[model samples]
Target: MGLVTIEKAHVASELLVLKSKLESEGVICYLRNEYTTQIMNYLPSFEVELQVSELDLEKVREIMTRKDAE
Candidate 1:
C-alpha cells in the first residue's frame, strides 16, 4: 500500500501512542517529522508531524475513536 496522511500536526507523544495502537490492530503506520530535528541537545524538543498509511486509514481512525473514549 502507498502512504497517505491521515492526520497532521499531531503531538509527538500522541503520535507515538497512536502508532503503537495502530500496530496492535495490525495496521502499518509511519510518522514523518522531517523538520522537527532542529533542536539543541541540551534543551527540550517540541515537534509535530503527519501520520500516515494507505491501508490503515480506517483502522487508524477506529483506534483513535477508542482511544478518545478512554
Candidate 2:
C-alpha cells in the first residue's frame, strides 16, 4: 500500500530525523544501511536506504528532495 526510498547516503542522526518526521505524519518507515563488503580491500562511503509505505512515497520524497535542504 505504501512505498520506500533510498533517500540519500546519510549518517545515523539525519536518517533518524527523517524517519521521525515520516512517522509523525502517519507514515511507516524502515531504515537500511549497507553492510561492509571487501574483497582483498576495504572501501568507504557506505550506502543507506530509507524506506516508506507506497502510499506515503510522495510525501516522503517531498520531504527528502527539498532543494533548500540539499
Candidate 3:
C-alpha cells in the first residue's frame, strides 16, 4: 500500500499525541524523519511528517479535523 502524508509538525511532542490518537483508531500511523527532525531542529525545513496508508487518508483527515475543533 502507498503511504500519504497527513500532517507535518515541528514539535515532536505534538506529533506524538496525534500519532497516539491515530493509532488508537487503528489507522496505523507512521512518523517520518521523527528522530532526524528532532536532531536537526536547527533546520527550519526539517519537520516531522505524520503518514498513513493512502487508504486511510480520508479517515485520518476527519479525525484531525475533529481534534482541531475541540
Candidate 4:
C-alpha cells in the first residue's frame, strides 16, 4: 500500500520524536517536508508530516492517541 500522512506538526524536533516512537513500536514511518519545514519555519504550508504505510494507519492512530493521553 502507499504511504499516508497521519500527523502534522509545526516543529521538526517534535515530529522527529514522534517518528522515533512509531519506529520503536515497529511501525515504519517517514517524515515529509521535515527539512523544508525547518528551513521555512515561518511558513505554515511547510509543516512537518508523519507518514506511514496505508496498512498501518489504524495502528499509528492508536499509538498517537495513547501518546496524546500522556
Give the best candidate by TM-score: 3
- Model 2, span 1-70: residue lDDT tens: 6456757554545667767877887878776663332221244566566787787777767776773387
Candidate 1 vs candidate 3: the lDDT winner is 3
Q: Rank by lDDT, highest first.
A: 3, 4, 1, 2
Residue 52, candidate 3: how far off, in angstroms? 0.6
- Candidate 1 achieves a global lDDT of 0.64
lDDT for position 6 in model 4: 81
TM-score for candidate 4, please give it: 0.79
Candidate 3's TM-score reads 0.83
TM-score leaderboard ranking? 3, 4, 1, 2
The digit string of per-residue lDDT tens for model 4 on 14-34 reads 777889999999999888887
Q: Record all residue pairs in model 4 with backbone atoms less than 3 Å apart, i.e. clashing.
A: none
Superposed Cα deviation of residue 4, candidate 3 (Å)? 1.0
The residue-by-residue lDDT of candidate 1 on 1-70, one tens digit each, is 6788765543456566667777788887766663453343233443455456766677777778888899
Clashes of 2: 7
Against the reference, the lDDT scores of all candidates come to 0.64, 0.63, 0.88, 0.88
lDDT string, candidate 3, 1-70, tens digits: 8998878988777788889999998889888988998788999898888889999988998988999999
lDDT against true structure, model 2? 0.63
- All models, RMSD in angstroms: 4.3, 4.7, 1.5, 1.7
Candidate 1's C-alpha runs over 4 A off are 9-11, 34-47
